[model samples]
Target: MSAEHTASAPAGPLWRLALGRSLGRSRKFLWFLLINILPLYVASDLLVTSGALAKISGFLEPVMSLWGLPPEAAAVLLAGMLVNLYAATAVAAPLALSWQQVSVLGLILGIAHSLIMEAVVVRQLTRRYHALTLLRIVLGLGAGWLLALVLC
Candidate 1:
């Protein structure tokens, strides 16, 4: 109930940002954001805004460029892979990506989101977790490539 702890709904893409924000200003969402998203955003923000990621981004640019994304998208993609799509999205909102680029990112994450956790969940259900995980990643990238080629 305190002023400092209270956060307004987030702003950005309509459905993912606005609707989710409106529906998700609850305590649990706040806790999840603080715990799961904030640190990633903080580190990504520091690296991105401070220009510290330039060198790393240089190395990643080629890979991200395949998806018609900028090097900063690597952070967004990493956040999605290591954490969850929501976290990746939260991290990505400030990057000023175009609608088409966001769409490409969405296409990739939709197929391969939350690999670290989902892979474990998949492992619990099947013995082919590694293959499935690899397939998702490869398919995700391939899908992104196709989408980027089409969109751009």
Candidate 2:
């Protein structure tokens, strides 16, 4: 085979191969969203509608109050850690939090959201998943407290 002809053939096939692989990945991600994110959105909506979230918030009031957050803020933090940021926002939207409270919550959740799903990812990447998970929670709480001191 001629050198130029072999080079061009490989280049053309490589481009098509990369495009096909990317399309396959996109389809897989779309299915992942439908299976995972859609149910979380629905469950978060139901929690808000049923008032069960309020009950959970009430129970966590004292603990949350210690961090300079409202009782309702507990639900947002719990949702963020257990589910994802979208679930947390769904819980947070109706609460009418002050700027300080929102800032603190944002800092905390940014540090330690999606514990279950993320822990699995962490475990896959490292053997110290338990320690890392604990560290994240502690860091998130500490950051929230520091933000409350400054912002609140």
**Per-model TM against the reference:** 0.74, 0.66
What does candidate 1's lDDT look like per residue over 13-67, in tens digits?
A: 5466545657767868779879977787777777778777766677888878888
Per-residue CA lDDT of model 2 for 37-105, tens digit only, reads 677656756776687766777877778876788776787898899988877876677676788898899
RMSD of each: 10.5, 6.4
- lDDT of candidate 1 vs native? 0.83
Q: Which candidate tops lDDT? A: 1
Supply candidate 1's per-residue lDDT for 52.
Answer: 75
Clashing pairs in 1: none
lDDT of candidate 2 at residue 43, scale 0 to 100: 72
lDDT of each: 0.83, 0.82
In candidate 1, position 79 carries an lDDT of: 82
